[model samples]
Target chain A: MLKVHNLSVNYRGTEALNSVSLAIHAGELVGLIGPNGAGKSTLLKALLGLVAMHAGQVLFEERPLVHQRQRVAYVPQRSQIDWDYPVTAWNVVMMARTVRTGWLRSPNPRSRQAVEAAMQRLGVWDLRDRQIGELSGGQQQRVFLARAIAQDADLFFFDEPFNAIDKTTEAVILDLLAELKAHDKTVLVCSHEWGQALNRYDRLLLLNQRLVADGDPQQVMTLDNIQRAYGENLQPSERPAEMPFFC
Target chain B: MLDWLLEPLGYQFMRNALAVGLLVGVLCPIVGSYLIVQRMALLGDVIAHAVLPGLAIANFLRFNILLGSFVSGIFSTVLIAWIRTQTRVKVDAAMALTFSSFFSLGVLLLRVLGSRLDLMAILFGDILSVSRADVGRSLWVTLLLLLLVKLFYKELLFYTFDPAAAEAAGLPVHTIYYGMMAAITMTIIVGMQTVGVVLVIALLVGPATTAYLLVKQLHRMMLLGALLGVISSLGGMYISYYLDVPSGPAIALTSFAFFMLALLFSPRQGILTRRRPLRKP
Candidate 1:
């Protein structure tokens, strides 16, 4: 389980996240939904300790998350990665085992096995030798997902995994999340998905510079909560054709 | 061919220059591969120029110039990072500012001190005039760099490819970053002996980029780049010896010629001989 207490993040003197707090139990798949600049990605980065937090702390099972980063895995947005980087798909997945393999040493047999199994599970084993830039967009997404899986961490954080990916990759990610839940792992996915896709998560946290709502998907998708997070300009009930928010 | 190659070895200066050139050739591409991958090729130029101030100060203070060159090089990168992070100024602007100021300071210090160091030789290397001490220093750097790079290959690879993920995995990304900067600084100092500060960036970036056009892995790029760098350095030294040209410019031009060849004929990403498209794997 992960616990965040009064977390605040500031960017250039402006508060990006203010007094935000939330918790997720093990075996749960939680979707963090918010509009642009709503601190969704900032929340993930804060939890992973990738950025300096203005206030408060994040705890995973009683210890500070920053100290226990070895037990966590993060898949950053695809846009954050450079596809033109001269690395094979296999090399990208092997990177997940770098820290665990220890310094001044090559990956041991067990580490190599984990990388191989993860790549195979994600159906990218066939493209192992191919350059990452040569792969399709969906294949690139799958490669990153495989990297996260190869880490074998107890907690996983995904930033915008659904953005610009094909439906097949989406289905594969949902299936993998289900598998993680079955294994009693925790997952926090930062997503921009709406409507039926939101149903895939066990719970949803609507955020707009703060935690506006948190509960079951149907309960959190109320017009009042949507308007509070996405602004009053979107009238979901009156504009059913335009609104893809209702679960 | 054997007679011509053997004729240069009879001279002591040629022997020392050849040793220094080959050592630097192998060293530059290894460190340069990281810079090219991180898209910090310009940083190499910044560090090379910044070394001038260090060299001037070291001469004035009566110390080893290499130590001063290294400290100044690392300091320049730190200052650039600090400016970019603390202010809205972009990295390119920070680099340009740091490079010019340090170079100007070096020039002024050299003139004020009136040291025995030759500005012309420092600006445009005279490889044929190198002493045995220079060869020893170049050899020491080459060994140290090769050892460090071999020991930290995986950590550097992960950090260069995706720093955020490396940090999330508790890989000490910041330490790795500074370590890379140190390695690059050491390389520029060694390379300056053969190609001088102005042309060192060519040795650092050209061969690595040329290798990048033909290879898909970081290590392969380094291996191939080293081979190409050796060819360029040796070829340039021979040309300079035969044609009465400057060693620095000759080496730079040779490296550029190799790069042009790869740009046109690379199988994967060449303008003229593309065997496979970049997409549609």
Candidate 2:
């Protein structure tokens, strides 16, 4: 289980989140949704210790998340990666084995096999030798996903995994998440996906600078909750006179 | 052709210069390959120039020049990191502001202290006057760099390609980052004697960038870049010997020339002849 208690983050002297708390258990695929600048990504970063929090801490299985980082795999936003880096998909996947392989040594046979399996499972086995820059947006996302899969961690954190990706990559990622959930691994994904894509997650965290709602997809995706989350951006004046519902 | 090549090898000074050139030839490209791939080529230039103040002070005090240069180089690295993180300045902007200002301060201090250091040789290079001790130090530094890369190849590749992921994967990322900075500083400090301060970045960035266009993997890039470095350094030394040119500029020009040739004719990425391999001689 993962517990984030009294989580608050301040960005440039402004509180991005105020006293938000949440808990998630294993075998759960949770989606984090919020408007732009509402701290969906910030919360993930804070939990991973990639960003400093003005208050709060993250615990996994009753221990600090930092100590158990070996079992945690993070895939940053797609925009953060350098596609022109002189590396292939195979090399990207091989990076996940570095920590397990240890210092001053190459990846053992087991680790290599894991990399091969992850790429094969992701349908990127044939493209292993291709440079990342030469890959499509969908393929690039899959490559990073393949790297995460190769980590074989108990926990997975993905930020904006569906942004700008093709439908195929989206389906592949969803299937992988389902597979991970079946194996009792905890998965937290931050995305703006609504409607059908939102149904795949066991739980949805609707956030807008704070925890607006956290519950089942049917309950959390209500009109009231949707309005509360994106209410500021929902301008009633912009809608047609016949359509009364702004959400 | 063999006699012409052997002619320069008879003199001990020429031999020592060639040794220094060879060492630097192998050193710069490997280090530079990392810089180029990470889009941190300017960082290399920054450190190379940042070593100036320490070198000037070392000349003033009459101690080992590399020691002073090293101290100043480390200081600049720390300062750059600090300024970049402490302010809104981006990495490139911070480096630009740091290297230029540090270089100016070094020139000022040199003038204030009235050191007899030849700015020309230090700025360009006088590889002909390289001593045996300098050659030995360059050799050791090259060996040390090679070992560091060999030991941390996997970690470094991950970190350079995607640092956040590397950090998330529980690697000691800060240590790796600082260790790389230290290595770059040491490489520049030792490389001062062969290519001097101004043109040192040429060795650090040019060959690796050329190899980068041709190779698909990091180690292969380093390996091929090293080969190009050695050939260019050796060729530049010969050009200097026969044409009565300055060694540093000659070497830098040779490296740039090689890059131009590769850019136009490389099998994988050449603008003119890409998509087809050249016929073997």
TM-score of each: 0.96, 0.94
Q: Chain B TM-score for each model?
A: 0.96, 0.95
Q: List the residue pairs that clash in candidate 1.
A: none
Q: What CAPRI grade goes to candidate 1?
A: high
Badly placed stretches (over 4 Å) of model 1 are A237-244, B275-281
Give the candidate number with the greatest DockQ: 1
Per-residue lDDT over B1-281 for candidate 2, one digit per residue giving the tens place of the 0 to 100 score: 99999999999989999998898888899988888888999998899889889988888889888889888888888898898767778998899999999999999988999988888888888876699888888889999999999888889999999988888888888788788998998988777777888989999998899999888888989999999999989999899999999888889999999999999998878999866667899
**What residue pairs clash in candidate 2, if any at all?**
none
How accurate locally is residue A91 in candidate 2, as Cα lDDT from 0 to 100? 95
